[model samples]
Target chain A: MTNEKNKKVVIVDYAMGNIFSVKLACQKVGICAIVSNDKKEISNASALILPGVGAFADAMATLEKLDLVRTIKEFIASGRPFLGICLGMQLLMSESEEFGLHKGLDIIKGRVVKFPAVNDKVPQVGWNQITKPSYSNINWEETLLKGLSEKDFMYFVHSFYVLPNNNNIVVSETNYAGLNYCSSLREKNIYACQFHPEKSGESGLLIYRNFYNLINK
Target chain B: MKNIRIIPRLDIKGPNLVKGIHLEGLRVLGSPEDFAEHYYNAGADELIYMDVVASLYGRNGLMDIIEKTAKKIFIPLTVGGGLRTLEDIKNVLRAGADKVSLNTIAIKNPNIILEASRRFGSSTIVVSIEAIKQNDGKYMAFIENARESTGVEVFSWAKKVEELGAGEILLTSVNNEGTGSGYDIELTRKVSELVSIPVIANGGAGELEDVVNVIKQGKADAVSLASMVHYDYVKKSMVNGSLLKNQAEGNIDFLKFGKISEKIETSGIEEIKFYLKDKGINCRK
Candidate 1:
C-alpha cells in the first residue's frame, strides 16, 4: 500500500458533493485521493469513491452532463472496489422520490424515498448509532465495520433514505423516531454508507481505514 | 438514536480568537488554529467559526485560518459572519468549509437561501438566528452580530427559513450569550419545536448540566459554546499576559484589559463529554 500505484483513490466530482472533505478524509488515511470528473482518471484509479451532499435529481443531472454515468457503470462492472457516501450511495439505486420521480444508476435494486413525516426531524441530522443486522451470519468485522463497535455513532445529514428490494445486501440499520432505516449496504466489491465517515471523528476515520484496508486486500 | 453534537464555537476578530460578555467588550484569546486543533484532539463533534466583526470589517477574513484548520481537522467546519453573496459562500466552501451560515444577509435577501441551497444543497446552508426576549416574552430575531433588530419573530422566521430551503437552524440567545448563565430553554424549545430541520442551541451554557437541560428540555439537536469552553482559557491567558504578547504585536491589546480570571482550571471537550455521559446522555466517547 505504501507504493504510489496502490495508494491512489479517485473521488468522483460531478459538481455536487463535499469533494474537499472526502479528499481530506482519504488523505487522513494515507491515501492519495484525486477529485476528478474525467473518465480516464476515474477508470484508471485503484478504487473509486462516490461522495455527495445534495438533491438526488440535481446530482444525476450533473453526472449525465459530465457523461460519467456510463464511466461509473463500467468501473463498477470491472469488479474493482467502489464506495459511496450519503447521496452518492442513493444515486446507485433505481430511482428517487425526492421532489418528483427521477432515475438513478440502477446498479442496485432499490429506490430512494423521503423519510415519512413523523414526529422526528425531517433531515435527521447529527450523529446516530449504526446497528448491524441481528440475524445475519456475515462477519461485519472483516469488512467496513472493521475496528468499529456495534453501535458506534457516525455523522449524518439527509432527508431521504434508500429502500433496497433485497435485504441481504443491507449491512447495518439505524433507528430514528422508532423507525428503522438502512444505514449501510454491501454487495461484494461495492459498498455504501449513508453516514459521513469523514465527519464522524475517530470512529469515522477508522471506517475509512477499514475501507482502505479492504482495497489493499 | 442520534447522539447530541458538542460544538466549540470560536468567535474570531481578525486572526486572533475573542470572546465577549453579552456579545460586548471583546477580549482576544489565543490563536484560532491552536484552539481548533485543541478541541479537535479533545473530541469535539464539530466546529463553528464565527467572525464576530466580519460585517464591520468589510468581508469574511477567516479563509487562511479555515484552510489551515481544514488541512488537519477532518470534522465538519461551519463558517459564519459576513457571508452575503453566493460567491462568498463558494469561496468559503472552496477553502474547505463544509457549511456556510447566513444571518444578516438572509434577512436582507431571503432568496439567497433558496439560491444557495439550490446551488450547494440544503445541507450546506445554515441560517443563524440571534434572538432576544422582548418585553412581551416573544423572541425577536437580531442580525449583524445581534447589534440590530429585524422586528421579525424568531419562531416564524425559523419556519420561513426552513421553508426557504435552509438545512439547519442555529438559534442564539442574545441575552444569554457570553453570560454563561445557561441557555434560554424556553426560547430554544420554542424554536426547536417549531422547525422540522435540526436546531443548534447557542448562547448560555455554563456547565454540563446546562447542555443536558438544553438537549433534554430545550430539545436542541446540537449545542454551541464559546465562553463555556474559552472563558477560563482566555481569562488565564489574560492574567499571565501570554495572550497580551500576541495582541501587542498585532496592535489589538486594548481589547484585553476588561476581563480577569480567578479560576485556573478549564474543561476540555473530553471532560464535557464524560460529564454528559455520566448523566446517561449518549455522546460520542
Candidate 2:
C-alpha cells in the first residue's frame, strides 16, 4: 500500500459545485485535497470528486465551456476512484429532462427525470434513509458506504433522480412520495450519490473516510 | 414521503444570540457558536441564523459568524435579514451558508428572487414571509423583523414567490413568535397549500406537541424552533458558567442575573425528535 502522506485527492471545480464544504469535509478526514479546474492536476490525483449545485443545462454548458467534460470522463476511464455528488451525480447519466432534455456525460447509461407530482413537495429537501437495493446483493461494507448500517439517514435535496439502465450498478435506493428511485450507485471505480454527504453530519464523514481508505489501499 | 426537518433558529443581535416575543423585547442568550454546536451534536436537521437587526443597520453582519459556524458544523445553514441584492446573496453563500433567506428585499424588489435564483440555483434562494392575522381573518406579510407591513396578502405573496423561483419558504407568524403559544397552523397550512415547495413553520413553539401539530396539521415540511430549544439548553448547561463567558457583546445581564425567562417552555432537539417520531411524524434521529 502507498503511504497516506503520498495520496492526493482532487475536487473538480467547474465553478458550479459546493467546493468549499466538500473540501472542508476532506480536510476533516485527514485527506489533503485540492479544488482545481486544471486538467493536469485533476488527471494526476489519486481520487476525484465532482460536486455540483444548479440546473442541468447550465451545468453542462459550464463544464463544456471549461473543457472539463473530456478531462472528467478520461479521469474515470483511467480507473481512478471517482465520486459525484448531487448535481454532479446527475451529470453522469445519459441526459436529464430537468430544463428540457439536456445531454450529460453519458458515463452511466441512464436518464435523469423529475419526481412525479405527488402529495409531497417538488424538492424533497430533508434527511431520508438509504436502504440496500433488493435487486443487488451488494453489502454496505463493500462500497463507499462502509460503516453505515441499513436504513441510515442521509441528507438529500433535489427535484430529480437518476434511472440507471443497469440495476446492478445501484448500491442504494430511497423512496420519496411513493417513488422508489436510485439514490447512489457503484460502477467499477466510479461512485455517485444524489445526496450531499458533506452536509449529512457524522454519518456523512464516514463516506469521505471510506473514500480516503479506498485511495490508500 | 420525506422526513420533516427539525431546524434550530438563532436570532442574532450584534454578536449575541437573542430572542424576542412577537419578534420584540430582544433578550440576550449566550454565544451563538456554543448554542449552535450544542444543537448540531444533539441532532438538529438544519439551522437558521437571522440577523434580527440587520434591516435596521442596512447591512448583514452574519458573514463572520456564518464563516466561523460553517467551518465546524456540517448541516445545512440558512442566513436571513437585510440581504438586498445579488451581491449580498453571493457574499453570504460564499461565506458558507447553504441558503440565503430574503424578506425585506424580496418584498421591495420581487424580481431579485427570480434573478438570484437564476444566478445561483433556486435551492439557494429562500423567501421568508413574516405574517400577522388581520382584522378580517386574513394574513398580511410584514418585513423588518415584523415591524413593517408590506400590505400584501400572505397567500398571494407565497404563490408569487414560488413562481419567482424560490426553492423554499420560511413562514413565521408574528402573532405566535416567542410567545410559546404554538405555531400558526392556519397560516402555515394556507401558504404551504398554496406553494409546491417545502414550507418551514417558524415561531410559537412552546412544547413538543407544537412541533408535531405544525407538521401534522399545518402540513409543513419543516419547523424552526428557537425558544423551546434555546431555553432548554441555556437552563440545563449554559447557566453553569462553563459554556458562556461574558464577551461584552449584547446583554449578558440575563445570564449574570440568572434571570432566564421563566415563561418560555423548554425542550431539547433529541426530545423533540423522539416526540415527533412517536406521533408517526418521522424526524432525523
Best by DockQ: 2
Candidate 2, which segments miss by more than 4 Å at Cα? Answer: A1-6, B55-61, B260-262
Residue by residue across A1-217, what tens digits does model 2's lDDT show? 5456659899988877477889888988888899899989998889999998889999999989999999999999999999999999999999999979999999999999999888678898989999898877998899999999888889998999999999999999998978789999999999999999999999999999999889888
Tell me, per candidate, how large a share of the native contacts it keeps.
0.64, 0.64
TM-score for all predictions?
A: 0.92, 0.96
What's the DockQ for every one of the candidates?
A: 0.66, 0.72
Collision pairs in model 1: none
Clashing pairs in 2: none
- On a 0 to 100 scale, what is the lDDT of residue B95 in model 1? 88
Question: What CAPRI grade goes to candidate 2?
Answer: medium
Best-matching candidate per lDDT: 2
Q: In candidate 2, what are the lDDT values of residues B170-192, reduced to their tens digit?
A: 99999999888889999999888
Candidate 1 chain B: worst-modelled 10 consecutive residues by lDDT? B257-266
